[model samples]
Each structure stands twice: as C-alpha cells, then as structure tokens.
Target: MTESTAPETGTPSGATGNRKPTPNGTTPEPVDTSATETSAAEPTAAATTADGASVETGEAGTAAATTPPRKRAARSPRTTTSRARSTANPSNETPAPDAAGEPSASAEQPGSVSIPQARHAAPDEVDSAAPADVEDAPGDTVDGDEVGSAATPVQGGGGVVDDGAERPVVLRLTDVVKTFPGVRALDGVQLEVRAGEVHCLLGQNGAGKSTLIKVLSGAHQPDSGVVEWLGEQVRFANPQAANKAGIATIYQELDLVDDLSIGENAFLGHEPKVAGFVKRGTINRRTREILTRLGHGEIAPNRMVRTLPAAGKQVVSMARALSHEARLIIMDEPSAVLAHDEVENLFRIIRELTAQGIAVIYISHRLEEIREIGDRVTVLKDGRTTAASLPARTTPTRDLVSRMTGRSIEYVFPTRVNAPTEPEELLRVEGLGRAGEFDDISLTVGKGEIVGIAGLVGSGRSELLETIFGARQPEQGRIYVKGKALRPGAVGAAVRAGLGMAPEERKAQALLLGEPIYRNMTLSTFSKIAKFGFTDTGKEREEAMKVADQLELRPRDVRRPVRTLSGGNQQKVVVGRWLLGDTDLLLLDEPTRGVDVGARAELYQVIHALAAQGVGVLLVSSEVPEVLGLSDRVLVMREGRMVRHARAEELDEETVLDLVMAGSLMEGAPA
Candidate 1:
C-alpha cells in the first residue's frame, strides 16, 4: 500500500465553480453572463488529436478535427466580419482561430523559435494551465524545462557560498532595474548564479550586460530591485560594500596602479600592518604564496607593474582579486591582454576556484572561451533577457551568437579579395632590435599588400611596431622608407618619410581621448594642415570629414569628442587619421581587440579596402585566426626576431603555434 499526503486545495476544492480566487488573492469573474454561456455552448476544442496534432476552429463554430498538420482548414468569408467585431472589443469569449488551436508549428520547428521539451507531471495536484501568481511550495516538483527549485543557500561564514553542497546559490539578483537619462539600461533583470559554475553573460555592447555588472559591483544601483546575498536581502551602496561582501570584479581596463610594486598594488587599500606601519616583509611573503599558487612564482612581488610585460601585469591583477578572498569573481575580457599560454594559466586558476566552490562571472567577446569554461550562459539583448539559464554543453555557439547579435551571421570574417600584384616596397627594416624587448627583426611591406605580424604576447610584436614607427628607438637596426634611410627616435623624419602608425595603446599613444575627432584625425598631418607656420582649420576639417566618410563614421561630425564614440568607432577614427595623411606605410596594432562583432566585420572591410588602395599595411595581432584570415603573407615573430614567413594559404593555427614556440629563425639555422 502506498501512503499519500492530502492535496492542498483552496475553499472551492475540486469543483467546477463559477468563481475562484486568483493566484494574487483576488476573485476574477466574468462581468457578462451571456459571454459565459456562449463559451460553454460551443463544442469543446480538441486538446490534441491523434499523432499529437490539433483541431482547427472556424467562424461557423465548426471544429475540423481531421485537418492535416501541414495545411490549415479554409476559413469562411465571414472571418473578416468576425475579426472586425473582435477588434472593436476584447471579451472573455474564446477568440476564433484561423485554423488550429496550436497554430502552424511547421514554420517554427526548423527556424529560431524555441520549443519546450517534455517532462513528467508532478505527483501532487497538477494544473495544465497554472496561474502566474501561484508560487510552488518547497520541494514541490516542477516541469524541468519550465522552472527550477531555488538555489541552495551559501553555507560558509561571511556570506561566501560554500562548496560542499551539490548546488549553491552564490549570487542572486531580483527585479534589477537601472535607468540612464532617456535610456532604461536594465529593466526587471533577474539572474541567479551557483557556486562552482562558470556563468557567461552573453550580449552585444549596450545590451545591459555591462550595466548589470555595474549594478552587481555597486558601480551603479538599480532604481528598484533587491540584491540578495546568500538568501539574505542586502543593499550595496558602493563598490567597496560589494567588495567587502566578497565580490571582486576585474574589468577590461585593470585598475592596478602601474607605478606601484606588484605586492603594493595587490594589497593597495588593505595592506598588512603591524601596529601603525605597513608590514612590507609579511606582505611580500603572502604575495609570493598567492603568485606561486597561480603558477607564476617567477613574477617578483617587488617589481613595478609598469615594468612587467602585459601578460605578467594581467596575472598581477588576478592575484589582487585572489588576495581579497573573493568568493564570486567577475572577469570582463580578462583574456584580451593575454597570450595563448597566459590564457591557459588563467583557465587553470579559474578551474581551481571552481574546485574550491567559488563562482566566476566571465564576460568575453571571444566565443571560444565561452565553450571552454562556461557551464551555463545567459544572453541579453536591448536591456532584456533573450535567453536565460542555458546549459553550455547543450547550447550551440551559433545559437548564442544569433541571440546576442539579433541576426544570423554565417561568418564572422568578411571575404578577402585579391590584393594588388607587383606592388612597390614602401617600408623596410633590417636587424631592428630593442634590447630586452625584441631583437634582430627584419621585414619589408610592399604597397597594396597586407603583411601580418603574428606572435604570442611578450614576444615583442608591439615593440617591433614601436621601433619601426619611431616611438621606441631600436638599439641596433636600420629602417628605410621608400629606400630612404631614417634616423631612429625621430617622429618628424618618420612622418616626413610617409610612414604612419596607429599604436596598440589607442588611448595612450594614438589618440588624445579628450580631443575632438577632427583634431585627432589631423594631428598626424599637422604640418600639411599648416601653411607658413599658420594652421588652416578649413583644410583640417575638410580632410577629417573625407576620411570619416571613407571609414563610415556615424554622425559624420568631426567636431565630436572621440571619447563619446564606441570603441570600434574610436578605432576607426585612429585608423582614419593615418589614412587621411596618405602615408606610404601603415602600422595597425591589435586594430580589432575590443571592438564588437558587427564593428569588427566593418573594420575588416575597411582594412581590405585600404590594402587595395596601395597602402602598405603592417597588421599586428595576437589572434591567430585574424592573422590567417586577413593577411596575404604572415610573419611570425618571437623574442624580437622574425621566426617564420608563410603565405596565408600555407599557414594554419598549428603551424603558427609551432613557429611561435620555436622562438626565432636563428634556431632553425643549420646547427
């Protein structure tokens, strides 16, 4: 014999009653008695026919249950007259359907529409059409595809979610709403995170992904909503409050002080102290332990962050978060500055955190990482949830990208057209070496050709560009432009020789963020815009507008501040500056690093167009796919030396990785 618990039902239990209490504790009754009689008198529509098909309804109140699923029953001409009456007033009477109760599922099945999966009904009282306000009681079984039980609360002290449970809620956001002037950045956004899960927030720019992170980190506050921590509702007035609550956010622009030592930067605000003074020795000891755990024992705690390489500096930032005992860490584009090996190290650390029951909120534009580290994903678009709580193992990348961009993109990289043949050599470098940075680099780029420079981070790719562009003086080498020898460290000579570079650090070395687009576009060609030591504003504006139009700059107003534009648009302005100068050689370093997908496609088109115009292009990027797809010829560099040169057709990711790992052509010389 089976023992069963009594089903909990309200006052009108198991009765086909005229009046029932709504889920929100209100009685909703039909105002007109005639409408109720009309609905019941009509024959009951088929719930589901044989072969799981549905019946069709017509204006004559006739139900055709035998209609095929592919074709709908023809509606009588009276349908238009019936629709007209219905449009005039919406009533409780069941609306007339053109064909079937289920509508046409054929068109939706093969397309982007999401179909619900089947699940077993609960053992308790079941409602086929449950009301919205009816909250499920604790331990009540729900449809697996529709609803899930609330996450298990955190167990550890200090509000940090413990790792012992099978599933633990690390972060909870309810009804989060944020607004900016005329824009509602986020409206009623809801999210739940579990310990040990890598939750990816997938969205395009301005999709409220960044805005949601801001609110969680206390950088912005929702005008309305309750932020719950470990099942307890709490309000974070500032980032410090969130930090103290064990939430650490690592933004794309790392907030570490470059001038300070690694240990000092890691423990900036909360330094180890003894009595009244900072304990330098104690801090250094603890710093070494953290770095060693992160597989970077070689990173000196005393070294200034500015002096270290880009990859090392990124690791230092991660160390800072770990030092704070961050239980829920948010990484925004953490791999943007990292090389392949450094990215591997970061994944190792992330895995270690998950093992310890910590949650990671990873936000990245790189789809490959989402496949590797993400356990679950949430996609947002236009400040609303397009998809929520999708398992990474079951979801396809194409689906995620479609949800994020709101368009079906067959390919991310644009098609490359044939570049010019028999182009002239615009710039040449021989034995270009910057001591300690890179060494013995030699390459030449011809006009109307795109030459790609590929290497792992810290391999001196950026240094080579700087050396050739006169930003950094090469200790030993000669640079020639159009067969003319150029002096090292002389910007005037480089620019006069018809060479221009869009530096890797766009904000620092390329554009004056505070300046207007027109000023930045003409900044490189100031001498041409000046006549007899007098600046010509008219010529500057005219030149700037021309390039802006060429790059498809929106607004087309050259006077707007560059800082106001998106990252992709700003990069275009920087590239436009050099293009306007009509430089014989163009050096672009990481041109699409932080740009969104749509903008990246546009930028690639611009780059190819520039190459077709006979502008010798030197492209430096860490993304192997970008180099392989965009360049006519690829040059792999390591330790400041040109290691391998191959045609784009001959180079694959494996071959490039082998070349990068081999570390220089000198190693391949007949030994």
Candidate 2:
C-alpha cells in the first residue's frame, strides 16, 4: 500500500513529481522532473526520491517497498555476502532458476521457516494472501475486498470461496525488471494476486516466472522494483525475511533433507529445542497432525525422508511449509512427481488451503492441471507479462500454450513406423523375478520396437527397469541383450552387453549434475575413448559431441556443466551419454517426466529417430497417455505382476488406467 501524506499544496515530498532531491539534504527545492520520463521505467534503486519514498526498479537486489533510506541499510541481515558472491557467479556460468519457483544460482541457502509456535492456529485475517503481482494491468485489476476478505473453509472441489468478485490485493508490483549480463530475466513484468485466490503463474522454461518468484521469496534481491506486501511497500532481503513475512516456497527440486526424519525436516531451521536438545515428542506429534490434516495420516512422522516415495516426499515438503505458518505457498511443478490419483489428492489439498484464505502461487507446464486447479492465470513470455487477467478454466488451451512457447502447439506424437514383420530380437527378459519387488515379469523387445509400461507408483514398474539396467539383481530371470546374457546386478556387464538405461530419477540416479557435459556423457565410455591406458580427453570430447549433436543439445557447448541446463536439456544429456556407446537396446523410464511441451516434442522426435535406427526402446511412464502415444506395445503392471499386454493402437488411456488400477480393463484379459 502506498503510504504517503498528502502535501498541503504542491507535489508531496519524495513524490518524484517535478522535483529531483539531491542526496545532500537540500533546502525544500522544486527541481522540475516529469513522471512521464519515469513512466518508461522507474529510476535506479540507488536513487531515492526526496519525499521519503525510494524508487526500486526490478526484482533482484532491490528493497521490498522503498524503505526509509536509513532503514534500507539493514536489508537482508542474515544473507551471507560470501554465499551471495559464490551463487551470483557460478564459475563463469549464467545463474538460472532452480525450480519453476526455484532460486537462481546461490550459495547454501539457510533454512528460513520456523516451527509453528501455534500449530493449530488459524491465520489472522489481517494478512492471509499471496505475494505481489505487479502493475501495468491497465483496467483488469480485481478489487479483492469486493470478494471475501475473510477466507474461511468451504467444502469439496469448489475452489476458494471467492464469489467471482474482485479480491483484496495482497501483493502488488510495478514494472518489475531483472537482467543478467546478456539477458533480461524480467522485462517490466506486471502481476497481481488477491486474497483467497489461486494465481497460476504460467510460462515455458526460461520465462521469468521462476525469477519473479525468487525475487518475491527474497532469495534474489531485484535489480530495482516496488514490492508491495499486504498494503505496504516493503522489501524482503533474504528467504528468511520472506518466510517470516508469511510467504512459503516449495521449489520443484524439493529442498527436503533426505538424511533426516520427517519430523526433523519439518522443523529443521526452528526446531523445538531447549537447552541444546530438541523436543522430539512435540515435533513428531505436531508433524503427525499436519500430515493427518493434509489427508496423509498414513505417513509416519518418524519415518526417514529418503524412504518415502516421490508423492510422500512432496507431502513432507508441504508439511514443512505448514510448520512455517505460511499465508501463501508457492508450488513449483508440484504435480511432476505425482501419478494420476496422487494429482487428484494434491488438488484436494490445494482447494482446502485456498478455502482457508491462504493464497497459492502454482507454477506448472501442464495446462490440464492448471484448468483443474488454477483460478486467475498469468502468462510470462520471454521474461515479460504477455497475458494477465486470463481465466484459467475459460482460457483456450491453444491461446495459453501459444503465449508460453510463442507458437501454437498440437498435442501430436511422432508417427510410429511399421517395422519389418520378422524383426530381429534386441532384448529378451524371461521369468524376471526380483524378490518382493517384481516377479515372473517376462517381456521382449524386437528391433525398432518401442515398448511402454504403464502402472501405479508402487506397481514395480521402476523396479523392473532397474533390474534390466543391472542396478538391482533379479532373483530368477535372464536378461539377454542381442544374444549375450547380462550378469545380474552388474552395471558394467549390462553396458558391455549393448544395454543403456535413463532411470526414473534423472537428478539422483542418472546425471552427475555438477559435472561438465563431456565428462558425464563419456563416463560410461572411458574405456572406449582411452588410449595407451590413459584417458584421451580429445577422443572423449569427440565422442560426446557426436551424441550431443545427434540430440541437438542447446548452446552446443560440451564443456558446460549439466546443472546449468533446464530439466529437458538435462534429460537430453542423460540420454546422450548412452548414445556414445554400442547401445542397441535403450531403457527410458519416465523419459519426459519434467520436460516442457516444446522440449517434450523434441524428446519424442529423438526417441523416434533412435527407433528408426533399429534401437529397441523400452519406455515407462505414469502418464497413460504418453505410453499410449509413444509405444507400439504396452505392458500394464499391477503390484508385482504384469496385468495386461496389448498393442498401443488397440488400447486407450482409459483402458490403461483401468488396467493399472483394477488389474484388468473393461474387456481385456485379467491379471
């Protein structure tokens, strides 16, 4: 909220209205200045207007609202300068967003959220909404107070009890801009989020949505800009300040501590400790209540975080936010790791949160999820606001997608080829049984065949893929690549036998994130590229570059670190690593899991091209549609069993869903 006293006659002090006040505490001077010139862009943050109002220009490094120049000196009190320097300059690499709402390159960020002092306290009405959505909205501003200022609980899938009237503005920004050396991450972006609303932030990869959120989260100080939290112009210096201010961020790469217990992670920064000892019982009980409230009472608070499934980890992450007494929660690709039913559960929780007047900033590439879960929508294109005030449910998908990618997208798959009827067998798995994980799973892939597996999260689909990759030994099974049998539990043996796998968890199980592209790519092929018992770096690069080129890797620089690339590009690097070897049979588990639509299309083309070259591909995806679209043959798994098998053309997503859920489709063979 702009808080300035009205002048008795002329422009107010620090108004920037026809008066530029020099830093020297000059006499009440009236130097001529025009708001029109400032309209193009606000003045640099270093220059504060005379009327006690500081002009902040962008998201990064800027104070929240212009603070009294004296108060601004203490900005980001907890932010370590050394840490900032390391993150700001990533070894000559460009700093980018971590999650969709993830932080840009930064040193180790201190945990900010505190343990909930009042575990079951309802949020105060004075401040119960999201962070800022800025200016340049023209006339589409929804007066939030016209709607429900007091957000209370409502029942069912009906979104927050917004009676379709304008909501009270919780956060507002004007002409937010952030720039890097060669790129402007935010180009005068404008947005607004009202109380009790689900403001969906939409954009393709590299679109400023992440950057904007980071600025709001206080992880990245904006270059210059005005950040209005609640009704007062304010600036958050660090993530801790944002958290203390009632904003919670759940990044895409979930910042949970896998080594800790559920309760421990929930109260990491602000544990219930006294006399140097934590109150474990209190923390566990509170964590249990939070999980139960989230409809996940089954997840024990004492359980190790590493033991949980992707969905379970997500719940833990949310539990941490709840522990913070967050008024608004920022979810970055929250659904990426979830399966079909899990997504529904997530939506239920989201609705419940919003009903309590807690605003949610949802960032995702899936338009379908947006329609199902979002309220007001804002689209970011090339670091600028392309569209705001759009209705999530009513906006045409093509319009939303076109705005995101700057091109119309057709939900099309690469055409599958009808390979020779008598194709050579590339892989054969017979009586594959991994104690308790999967049993008697027999499958075959012929040359040029794209085989897909569809299953629930715990149906052992990923386990089967792991066994084939030699990450896990099968108790009773034979895996044959071409005609050679692979030794069980031997990654090297599998690699030597012309087999390759891009695992389900790419970040954890596939790529060495911080390694250079060439190193990560040629790691499995060092022997092939070695000369005189010495690793010939030149040969390694030549081989890695060949596969990198084949995949059309962006930037075309093999020396770049893998961590700096986007999710889609990172997946490509993982796939390209395998391409450097004699890989006739490729195993792809959730190949396009976190990739964007534009890059998803590119990945699909890469898969098709590999198949065209007679590479037998075995794929697995929780998304039934992806399996139905990309595979020639489909195998549905239920529990530890293969429930159904059919040609992709003969099945649909509905049938596959039924098979995974009930172990049989309407008229298909039963498990």
Candidate 3:
C-alpha cells in the first residue's frame, strides 16, 4: 500500500485517490466516475421540491428518488438553512415524468444536502483579499504584504482543480488576536484557505497553532481583528454555531463516544427526524453510505466505536464531519495516531474531500507530510504569523525550520560523545519475552552510552520499556544490571538495581499533579531526607532545587503544584526524581512527547550531561529523527519483534519507517 516513488505533475500523485497512473509518468487520469467513487464523482446539490421539502441525491446525484412525501421534517439543529449554492450545477433541470405519466418522487421530496464542490477560477480573477491601506488591529499587526503575495496556489491535483484553475477562498483571517489572562495565545495571526485545497499549519507546540484552531472552530473568540467566512465577516458564538456554519474540527484526542455505535456517533447532535422522533433507518443508511465512500464498507454501522482500532476511529471522525455537511474541516495532528499504511488511506480520503470541494486545514508536526499532501503553507511562531501562504512543495526545509524556531537548528541533537575503548556494560536483557506484547527482546546499554528504539505506538515500544523497568511481568527471559539477574515482576528489585524510567504518559504515569514539585522530585529518595520517622521538608526542597537548577526548569519554584507548571517543566520533575535517587541506568519513553521546541533543546542537554556523568540511557520514541539523532545505536521494532539493529549513523528515517511498517503493508486493502 506504499505510494509510488515515481515523480508526477501537480500535487503528488500519491495524493490522488481513485485515479489510475499512466505508465509514461504523466499526470494521472480519473478512471472511475461511479457515484461510489468519491474522488471522481461530483457532489450533487439539493433541490427544493414543490412542497418546499429539500431532497439530495445519492452519490454523484445519479439515484432516482423513490420515497414518497410525508409531513414536513424539522430542519437539523446542527445545520443552517441558509447555504451558499454550489456553482457545479447552476441549472437544475426538473425530473422527467415516469411511465404512469406522473413526476418521480424526487420531484416531491428532497434528501440531505451537502456543501457543493467548489468551482475553480483563473489566477487573475482570484481576489487577493483587502487593500494594502487597511489598518491593522490593536496589540499586534499582521504584515499585509506577506498575505497571499508569495503564494502561487498548487493546481491540477485536488479534484476539480486538475484543469489548472485556482479554487475560491473559503476562510480568511487577518490580524486575528486572542489572549488569555497571562498569555497572548494568538497575536496578529494571518491565514487563508481555499476551497478544494489542503492548507498546512506549521509551528512548535506552544507556537499558538492550537489557539488559532480554537478560534477558527469557534471554541474561543478572538480578542481583536477579523474572520471572514464565504466573503462575509462572522464571529461564531460557540462550537455549535460554527458547526452549523459549515466548520468542523477533529482534535488529536478524539471526542467520539465510546459507548455509542458507529451510526449513533456519526449523527449524535443532528439526527434526521419526523414528528420529533429520530429515524433510525435513515441514520444507519446515511452512515453506511459515508463509510463506503471513505473506502471502509465492511465496517458495520452497529459496531461499537470502542471496539475499533485507532485508524478506524479516525475514519469515523471524518464521517462525522461529512455528516454535518462541513465545508471546512480543521484536523489537529490527524496522522499522529495512524500507522504507515493507514496514513496512505487518510491521504486518499483527503483527496476525495478536496475533490468534492471541501477545504481542509491540516495541522501536523511532521514536515514530510506537508510535501506529500499540502497545497499551500502558513507558518506560525510566538502567536503571530511568521509567513503566510507559501508554496508547500518548493519551500526549502531550512526556511521552514527557521520560521518555526526563529533559528536555523533542526532536529537539535547535542553532539554525541565517544565512548571508551572498552565500555562498561551497565544493563542487559536476555531474550525477555512478554506474551501478547513483545518477545525475544535482547539488548544492552553500556556506561555513558545511549541506545534508542524506533517504532509505532502499538509496536510494543512502551511495553518493552515498562517490562525492563519491572512495571510488568515477563513470561520468560531475564534482565540484568551489571551482570546480575533481576527478579521478574518486582518493582522494588528493579529500583534497588539502579534502574529509573520516565514513562510515556508522564502526567498519568509519572507525576503527582496535585503535589508540589519538590515532593515529586524527592519521591524516589524520601528515606534519605526523613529522620526519626519524620520527613524533613527543608532538605527535600534543597535537593529538588539543585536538580531544578541543573535542568533549568522554568520559574524554579519547587513549592508550586506540578499541574501548574507547563508540560516541559512537568517532564523535568519526572527526570529529576531519578537524579535524586542516584540511578545508574535510565529508561525514557517519549521524553519529548509534549515539550515545545525551545524546552526540547534544554532537555536534550540535560540527557547528554547525564550520560557524560557515566549514566546509561535507553530511550524509545515514535519519531525516527529523534531516535537517530539522540542515540549511538538504534533498534527498529514492529508487531512485537525486533526487526532490525544498526548503529545510528547507518540508519535513515525512511529505512526505519520501512522496518516498522513491514507487516502492515501486506494487510488487506480498504474495501
């Protein structure tokens, strides 16, 4: 299921769903035009019948209406009545009479309506938006000259745009400003999205991308500046209002109801009804249709959402958006939870959505994805627009990195120090096996040496780390610290052996959110500070303050609750706990998972300093770059097996991805 590596024109050919590639390497041509083929068929516009009831066609508007007219149905609460008519079918011809000399049922009742596919316009005819003399809003000013001045919209890839016409602008923000009590989350942010295009939003974790998305999704109101949707200024009062206004957002942490069925979750807020009673048959049928278009027809509508896999959950989220007839969907870290092959499927679905004239604002940290699926780019830094509407494909990596970090450093790893000729083996694992999780895991970490593991979420990366730390019992094999065997399933034994672990879910697994940072830092070594059955708070704070200074934790306040600290500082406290314990070996799982770019650099130095002091480090991270850049040796895992082992300098990102996704490629294709 890997995308073609061969070059093609327009957007990447791998992004073109339901299209057949010609052998000559020319632009691919659409081969399937059936209604079920979402990328190839045009979305049908709803027509008002004589009785004033609206009717929508099945896929591509090919189905003949069969349902008879009943009582007038109440409008769906989640959808607005006023819609901008699609230019795709400007002239709606009346249905012809049947053999009985009467008009078809479609002439009497209309079905559900979807936002029409956008019509592409010539570049010269496109409006660049606002005159240069327009004054900026207060607090900050968006550089008007950079707005759409450098962007030449990529063409001939997203559905109807293959003819070289540029899609119309659907969402625009100019000098948008949003502020919290103590932080300015958004300052003079500028962004523009066009119908039938994927606009990528790039930034570091704390760079205000989340706040901007909340503003666009109507979860928060902008303090100043303007937001225009479909050529008119609008401020959505709440999330529901934005949903009704053809906007939807899918966050990284999914909002799906676990107990509900697939069909129920898809239509939870706005169920089709008559006489105040929901139509269960209608909900099931409509949901099935949407799933089929997404290339997952085998998924039963009655299946419980909790039973589905991560990729399945993502598809259901997209189905929910289409159910709302959303014209613009904001996806925050959509691919973060997906496996390699599943990501290809997601790109395919996105191609179909853009083909149907839906605008998408995709937010992700992976820079490689921007080149694969994005048409235009907008970079945000420090709550302000650093650059707006740049070409996603041709922009240099150095330029994008400099924009997001305000510096030239990328991957930001501290220089690796060479080990002694005969390194001291600090820890070792001998064929450790955990049934149903991981098997035959064998590795070693030497004094002052760093080893890294690269894998997907379910590839047993976290499980292996936890098992080594004695948090889980292994069914077979053995673990050793300094050539001594460790007792299986014993946390106390592992700790006494000088093994320290910083888990992946630090908030849920590592930190005591309600307690003071000093208390948490002293958790592993409280016995040393306690005298005569009474704890010494003064000594505890003194010990915590020393590590805080070394790690350069923000505010350096040991007495403040850990929850009050930012994500980066909270992680520092977890690492600091081990430091106070005088641990010889450290195991880190996703150490930089939520830390921002600036704080990440600081944490890297802390880790390097620890290794320089003769501590052995073994780390696991989903990001291949992090694994390779920060370690001397790398191991690739897939489906509970160690597939490849090599030095960090011998492996690249693509090679590691291939090793992790080997078995996934042979899985059955969607539908």
RMSD for each of the candidates: 20.9, 14.0, 15.4
Could you say which candidate leads in TM-score? 3
| Worst lDDT 10-window in candidate 2 | 81-90
Per-prediction TM-score = 0.68, 0.73, 0.75
- Please report the candidate that would top lDDT against the real structure: 3
Model 1 misplacement above 4 A: 1-166, 187-190, 257-325, 407-411, 430-441, 473-480, 483-489, 530-542, 554-557, 663-671
Q: Cα miss at 431, model 2 (Å)? A: 2.0
Q: Total backbone clashes of model 2?
A: 31
Summarize candidate 2's per-residue lDDT along 236-347 as a digit string, tens digits.
6666667656678887667777899999888777676668688899789878888876778788999999998888888887887777667678887788767666777778
Ranking by lDDT: 3, 2, 1
Clashing pairs in 3: 54-110, 55-110, 55-111, 56-111, 156-162
lDDT of candidate 1 over 139-213, digit per residue (tens): 222232224433533211112222322344546565567776656767655566665567877665555776687
Q: What shift in Å separates residue 135 of candidate 1 from its native position after superposition?
A: 32
Q: How high is the CA lDDT of each candidate model? A: 0.62, 0.64, 0.66
lDDT of 2: 0.64
| Best of the two (2, 3) by lDDT | 3
Count of clashes in candidate 3: 5
